[model samples]
Target: MCLLAFQLQKHPKYKLIMMANRDEAYNRPTTPADFWSDYPDILAGRDLEQMGTWLGINKQGKIAALTNHRDFSLPETGGQSRGHIVSSYLQSNETPEDFLEQLHNSKNEYSGFNVLVGSSEELYYYSNIEQKTEHLKNGTHGLSNAFMNTPWPKTEAVKKLLCDYAESTNEIDVDVLFNMMQRAERFPSEQLPDTGVGGELESMLSSIFIASKEYGTRCTTVLLVDSEDQVYFEERTFKNGVFATAQKFSFTIENPTA
Candidate 1:
């Protein structure tokens, strides 16, 4: 996932509300969100290339999402697939803290990344670049290629959009959340962050929804977990900058606290 904005335990009707966009190359093989035949409990879009996922939530209430840490200064040495970071956590029974602690040792085996893993009741954020695992507080937060809530123009704007929509209504609207993430408005040049990808590319990626000939947002996902343990997931995919198909799933957590 390239961008994420969420409200955790800050809304009256829902325990967790999240919207994310996954930007990738047009040719990367992928499967839309669904329960794996091999692991039926896991619901997520699969990266066919690595046999991993970027975001997922299993029937046991385990949720995980990952984003790459963009730093062109470092050489692109091949390493373990970062997508496995999300899939591994969702497939394991380890608590967020435990999984992160274990991952800390082998972080370098993979490229720099930021991962969020936890259940609807609790969530944590960790980044290999910063080498810190944070027990996320109950509030609205945003994550992108940088550190959590780093106030990059896109991050801040999306965070505010989520915070406003969440605070103003007791009932959550999935379409509204999806619409918020579809914003393709790039920020002003002066307000963009310098990620070493030049001004042109930086401006293009500044928007929540990215569209380019080669690399752009391929899909958008919305996840909502209510106080009653009802889980709702929806993924809308795009084909070469245009909408393609959408998949939706709903299920109640069997043992949310366990």
Candidate 2:
């Protein structure tokens, strides 16, 4: 996931909402959102090439997402796939804080990454480049590859939208969030982060909205986890190189003892 926006709360009907876009080379093999036969509790797009995923959730109410660091000039330190870092954490028995601590201590195990991991009681963020891992301070927050809440174009736009919607106190709606994402724009040259990555940065961020270009949004995913622990997962793909193919799922948790 390259861009992610989320709202976390203690509300009764909905507790968490997330919208993100996953950017990658088109040729990479992947399976769209579905129940993994091998791991029935897991629902996400699986990267066949890397055996990892950008975003995913488990039946146990564990949610995880990852994005690569934008520093393209950094020396290639061949390391573990960051996506697997998220998956491994979700599959573990540790709490979010514990998991983040472990991740911070093992930063050398992978390339730079921004990871979000949480269950019902805890939310945590970890960046290998910062060498810091801690629970998210309450309130709205957005993160991309650059840094936490650095005002990247997409992050800023989403933050504003989420703030507006949140202020309305309306039942959280995923469609409205999706529309906002579809309308998000790339940052103008002056607004682009000085990653030193140069031109490719422009291409990656700008191409998403340019019709003449072959790039834009690769996949858009929206997830809503209600206070009742019900999770709604929705994904839209641009096929034939351009256009949205819609898909959605709602995973409800039933109190087995009841």
lDDT values for all models: 0.92, 0.73
Model 2 lDDT per residue over 116-219, tens place: 88854456888888888767765677877777787777677787887788767758777787777776345578666766667665645642222224444567
lDDT top scorer: 1
Backbone collision tally, model 1: 0
Residue-wise C-alpha lDDT for candidate 1, range 142-252, written one tens digit per residue? 999999998999899889999998999999889999999999989999998788999999999999999999999999999999999999999999998899999999999
lDDT of 2 at 155: 78
TM-score of each: 0.98, 0.89
